[model samples]
Target: MKSWRDSVRNVVPYTPGEQPKEDGVIKLNTNENPYPPSPKVLEAMKEITNLRKYPDPAVSDLTEALSSYYRIDSSEVFVGVGSDDVLAIAFLTFFNSDVPVFFPDITYSFYDVWADLFQIPFERKPLNEKFEICAQDYYGENGGVIFPNPNAPTGALLELETVRDILDHNREVLVIVDEAYIDFGGESALSLIHDYDNLLVVQTYSKSRSLAGLRIGYAMGNRELIKAMSDVKYSFNSYTMNEPSIVMGTAAIKDEEYFQDTRNKIIKTREWFQEELRELGFSFADSKANFVFAAHESIPARELFEAAKKEKIYVRYFDKPRINNYLRISIGTDEEMQALVRFFKSMMNK
Candidate 1:
């Protein structure tokens, strides 16, 4: 039993949200777009008849598409399998020092996994009682820094000026602002990439573009950081993206109007859903992401999660310290969310 796994790889891996298989299940546990991907994306995927060849190692089409969309240089863009893959590559390429990287203790659950898997030293800075990252806590000397823009699970967004403060303070190390949920309403720190060489903004097609199945993500930063990540990517796996994903992701980005419509619809649904939750006696942060971090006044989060599951409605509940009472409910379609609200009401009435 004392093999390679026992000595160096002994750690708890990140647990993703449940992906229920039963039909008609209101799947809202994961922060995936409830809408189908753009019609253009599907059409583009259908055109890829040549599946035998390897995808472009450079990922040229997708990279150029991202650069064009963001109005940044092609040299500043780096694409990968997903934001998770991009962030992992960044961890491997940049966070190589004795000093510990810093991130919010309650943000994306995967941050710690990447740091630990890469054997990089890191510290989890606690969010305040409101589950907000205190920008001052990230001021002092550290290794690299990374955090979700709207901050995950909690869905509380840190403002741009405050992000600038962290960037200003940590000039010596890389600062990554994971904007996975920014399209939900939060301001991106991407514009600051022009002023700061140390800033790298990682984004994904999963949330905003309704292309999670395509599994494409990219980063924008100074040419140096992009080059470094690109080098690591090529050495590790040149074909990080498949032909279908590359073409489909580009098509998804190209249909900007549809993208905005879906994003806005989700935002509107979230606003309506928040008010409904408040009326049902649940308290939550002012979420700017596609999900709500909520806890009922009297009901335990575990009980609520189980009740939702029994009703064929799956929502995320993190049974962790300090956040055990809260559930992270992803915004589903209007009908799906209404069903969830009705289920909650029935439980409360009982």
Candidate 2:
């Protein structure tokens, strides 16, 4: 008789940033927004009294709000728990072919995890020496493609021309442009969607809109692609979003003034932090995201990571190849960033 253990499928899981429990810790590891959600979002949450009933299976209200904001048809929008949920469904829906999906070797770590969990074949194309994606590398045939616009950990932005080139080369397969950090500085590929029917542009409220707690993310593409992903999503879970998220997310999108104010603040802080890091002998690519990935000229990243923890200052340090010496420091409020600079100055002086 065959043992049940033989049927088990195992894969390495994705590790998220550490969420420290200590109070007064200057948390900056996870790249979370350093601001609160819009006041309108708070008001909307207070109005969500009907929790006894299940949420709309279609998530129509939030979907319509997103479509209106982006000036797209409702049929072109697909909402999910977060960008991760949207991406996972995309991988499962479009990457069933035998050909391998292509993404950067240094992209979002979840790409590989999702591919593995879904048993989809994938290949990691190496980024150039500058840690920027080479569009020519993706010119070859593949099942699908996905990469973040400003990228993660590296914060390198790929311009729309190059994005168009990639889309131009692989017109037969679906291409996903993950714009989680686009609001920080980089241009979004949403405009290219009308030109490239195979394109799916995914964005999140977690970063710019300061709505990570709401777990709201959506994708814009042609109606066909949106319909396919929605079908897959409904098959798995009809009510993936709760009533609170739908109401709060709709409010968050409508408050354009507050959204712009918070994101602009983070962008300004990131620029200031980058300059401070440079002065402290840290070197890195000019980041377009809300975080700066830097490496000290003399000290090791692990050393700085530990020293910051001792001071109750938190930042992300990856123990991976090529980027082992680098630290991804999330942009916080002006005061928090000033505190981080002080910690670095004190540590370097020691």
Candidate 3:
């Protein structure tokens, strides 16, 4: 008789950025917004009084809020626990073909994990030398395509024309644009939703709206695609979102002024930080996201990563190939960035 353990499924998990428990550390490992959620979100959370009842399984209120904010119909929006949850469901719903799905080799690491977990075949199309996605590479045959705009770690933004070029080629299969950081400085693929039925644009409040703690994420696409994902979600979990999250997420979407203010602050800080890094002999692509992927001319990234941690400053360092020498640093507040720059200056002086 075979043991129960032998029947268990096992796969490598996606390792997330470290969350240090201690206080007084400048945490920037995960690409989380350093600011608090909108005032409206806090106010709305105060109204979530009924803890006894189940939150709406459909997540209608939050869904409607996103729809209004994006100017799409509610039927074209699907809400989830986070973009991670939403993208996982998308991978499961689509990518059913025998051919391997395609995405950037250096994109959000979770894409490969989700594909592996779902037992789906996938191929990683390598980004160019500059860490930019090559549109022609994705023109070939595959199961489906998904990549982030202003992609992760590298923080390089693909223009809308390039996005359309890829979509134009792969109209037969679903193309998912993971826009988790679109609000930073990238033009969104949301405008192409009506032009291409196969397109699904996923965005989250975590980065731009400071709601990572609430785990609010959503996808906007054609009504048909939205229905398919919603159907799969309901089949899997009826109430993926709780009452507080639903109310708070709705409030976050409604506060457009606060959202814009915070997003601009992050972008400004990111630009300033990049200039500082360059002055310190660092090289990186011009980033449009909230973070910068940089490599020093002489110092190894691991050394800098350790040195920064010792000073109570945290940033993301990927030990993967190609990017092994690079560090992805998130943009914090003005004072936080100044301190980071000062730390770098001290390291150089040594």
- Report the backbone clash tally of model 2: 0
- Residue 319, model 1: lDDT of 84
Model 1 Cα lDDT, one tens digit per residue, 250-286: 8888998998999999999999999999999999999
Per-residue lDDT value at 308 in model 3: 98
Model 3 gets an lDDT of 0.92
Across residues 165-233, which tens digit of lDDT does each residue of candidate 2 receive?
999999999999999999999989999888999999999988888888889889999999999999999
Candidate 1 has a TM-score of: 0.98
Score every model by TM-score: 0.98, 0.98, 0.99
Look at candidate 2 and tell me the lDDT of residue 170. 90
What is the TM-score ranking, best to worst?
Answer: 3, 2, 1
Off by over 4 Å in 3: none
lDDT of 3 by residue, 1-350 (tens): 77999978889999988889999999888888989988888899789899899888988888888888788999999999899999999999998999999999998989999998999999999999999999999999999999999899799999999999999999899999999999999999999999999999999978888888989889999999999998999999999899999988888888888888998999889988898889999999999999999999999999999999999999999889889999999888989889999999999993
Off by over 4 Å in 1: 1-8
CA lDDT of 156 in candidate 1?
Answer: 97
